[model samples]
Target: MRRVAVIGTGVIGASWAAHFLAHGLDVVASDPAPGAEARLRADVAAIWPTLAPIDGASPDRLTFTADAAEAVADADFVQENGPEREEVKDALFAVLDTAARPEVVLASSSSGLLPSVIARGCPEHPERVVIGHPFNPPHLIPLVEVVPGEKTAEKTVETAMAFYAGVGKRPIRLRQELPGHVANRLQAALWQEAYSLVERGVATVADIDTAITHGPGLRWAVLGPFLTQHLSGGPGGIAHVLEHLGPPTEAWWRDLGQVTLTRELVETLVAGVDEELAGIDRAELVAHRDAVLTALLAAKARTELP
Candidate 1:
């Protein structure tokens, strides 16, 4: 798409606008919140340097409006990142539906909400409503889950996939709708165990962080869990690895804990993180993370990993 309408200038929306601009698309973003335009511009400016914008790509191409309808007036595609509540989504999509062209695809950056609920806002052409969920900062992360609702047209899916891929994103299409999609669900599985560990006093928060960052996290950065496990099997591959490790793995699964984040647990988790980050400046930590992530992405780009 030559022009993308970002219908919320929050973190995710701003990041998506920056990403689209870096890929040479014109971006028009809208958010009703006070100072949203200025904040969006600043956010885009901060993220621009990391993008290495392509030819014809420039922050100058970004535009802002307080009205979502105005933002999508001439956009070829729309990426919605408004509030996550179902009512808000339905109402917002209704506005987008009325303002945007009939054929233009409207994509939501919702992490867990169903596209069907999002489509409910669009009476004219609910088929154009789809989910284009992205992880945290879209400017850096590549994963975009392109999910279609019950009424979403096959053509809309194809267009969303193509548009996302064209902008240098790694887009995956879900065969059916599911809460939290796939990646987030995978993350939740690990998070659940991590929280359980903390609640049970099995490991300190800092130690748990170390266990992942120095161990499996390092491997996971290069490949997903399945591929990493395949390598763990050596020449025997995943099948052989499963044969040898399946029993213990199943037992461990059976032992895995289920947890509820009660008030006490929340406080404990927050306190643990505070302790872990003691003496570390939050800004510096984020900068270091961004720098390292950029390098990692570059390294992966030069490799043949999937």
Candidate 2:
């Protein structure tokens, strides 16, 4: 798309604006919050450096507006990043659906909310609304879950997928809707065990973070869990791993921890994170993470693994 409208210029919205601008698209953004324009501009400026070297991007084409309608009135595509509240999103989508051109595809960056519910207010043209959920820091991350509601048109889904792919994103089409979608569900499962370990005093927060980042997280960056397990099977691959360890793996799954975030557990988690992050600036940590992620993606791109 040559011109894109970004509704809700929050962190996610701004990141998307940066990404689209990096792809050489003119971006018009709108958010009602006080000083939103300044924050959006700052965020895009901060992220532009990282995006620039990859695709020769610049921020000269970015513009901000206080009116959401004006932002989407003549845009080719609309990326809505409104608050996660259902009532808020439903109302926002109605406004967007009414303002945008009938053929313009409007996508939500909702993390877990259903597209069906988000589009329910726009029965007149629900077909054009779909969920295009992106992981945190959308400009740096590549995964975008493209979920179509029951009423969403097949053509709309295709257009959303193509749009994200054209903007240098990895778009996964989800056939069914589930709360938390795919990645967040996987994350919840892992975090359940992580919290249980901390609750049981088996490991500290720092230890757990280190274990993942220094160990499996490193491999996970290149290959997912299934492939990692397949590689672990030596000559036989995944079938062998399953044949030999399937029963034990099943047993382990049965024994995996389930945790409720009670007050005490919450306090423990808070204390642990506070201690872990003591004396460190969060911005510095984020910068370090993005730097390493950039290098990792570059390295993975240069290598071919089965």
Candidate 3:
């Protein structure tokens, strides 16, 4: 698609706009918030430097509109990144379904809310609505979970997948509609145990963060869990790991901690994070992380890791 509409100019929406513009597509964006246009432009400009060498991005192709309908009108695709409220999304989708062409796929950037509920108000063309959830900092991250609701047409799913792939995103088609999709669920599972550790005084927040960032996180960036486990089987591969270690792994899983975020636990987590980030500036940390991520991605591209 040559042109696209971005509804809601928040961080995710702005990142989507930047990524689309980096691929040389014209972006018509709309956000009602005061100074949203200026912020969106500044965000695009800031991120353009990172994307320019990769895709020759130019900010000249972006247009900001006050009306969401005007933004989506005549657009090839529509990406909605509004707030994560069912009622809000339902109302917004009703308008978008009417404003955009019938064939133009309308995707939501919802992190977890199901497309089925979000598009419930779109009686005329609920089939065109689907979830196109992207990881944070979409300009750098490659993952985009393309999930279709029950009413979403098969052709619409195919179109959404193809469009995301065409724009250099790694899109995965989920077979079932589950809350939090795949990655977020996996992250939540890990965090559940991580919080348990902190709650039980097994590890301080800094210690846990360091353990992941310096240990598993490094390998995870290159290979996922199953592959890493397969490789860990010495010459036996996953079959052997499953055969010999499966029972022990199951035992460990059974013994894993479960936690609920009570008030005390919440305070503990907040204080731990505060102590960990005592002197660090949030913006500087983000910049450092993004720089490292950019370099890591470039290095990974030169290797055969898949």
- Identify the candidate with maximal lDDT: 1
lDDT pick, better of 1 and 3: 1
**Candidate 2: which stretches are off by over 4 Å?**
53-57, 304-306
Model 1 per-residue lDDT tens digits across residues 1-306: 688999998889988999999999999999999999999999999889888889989999998899889999899999999998999998898899999999999999999998988899999999999999998779988899999999999999999999889888899999989999999999899999999999999998999999999999999988889999999999998998899999999999999999999999999999999999998987788778889888998999999545
Q: How do these models rank on TM-score, best leading?
A: 1, 3, 2
List TM-scores for all candidates, in order.
0.98, 0.96, 0.97
How far is each candidate from the true structure, as Cα RMSD in Å?
1.1, 1.4, 1.3
User: Of the pair 1 and 3, which is ahead by TM-score?
Assistant: 1
Give the higher-TM-score candidate: 1 or 2: 1
lDDT per residue for candidate 3 within 1-306, as digits (tens), equals 899999998999999999999898999999989999999999988888777433545789899998988899879999999999998898888889899999999999999999899879788899999999999899899999999999999999999999999998899999999999899999999999999999999999999999999999988988989888889888999999999999999999998999999999999999999899998988888788789988988888899555
Expressed as tens digits, the lDDT of each residue in 1-306 for candidate 2 is: 799999998889998999999898999999999999999999988998887533445687888899988999999999999999999987888888889999999999999998888889686799999999998889889999999988999999999999999988999999898888889999999999999999999999999999999999888877889899889999999999999999999999998888999999999999999999997888998899889878877787689565
Candidates' C-alpha lDDT: 0.92, 0.90, 0.92
lDDT at 297 for candidate 2?
Answer: 72
Model 3, CA-based lDDT: 0.92
Q: Where does model 1 exceed 4 Å of error?
A: none
TM-score between model 1 and native: 0.98
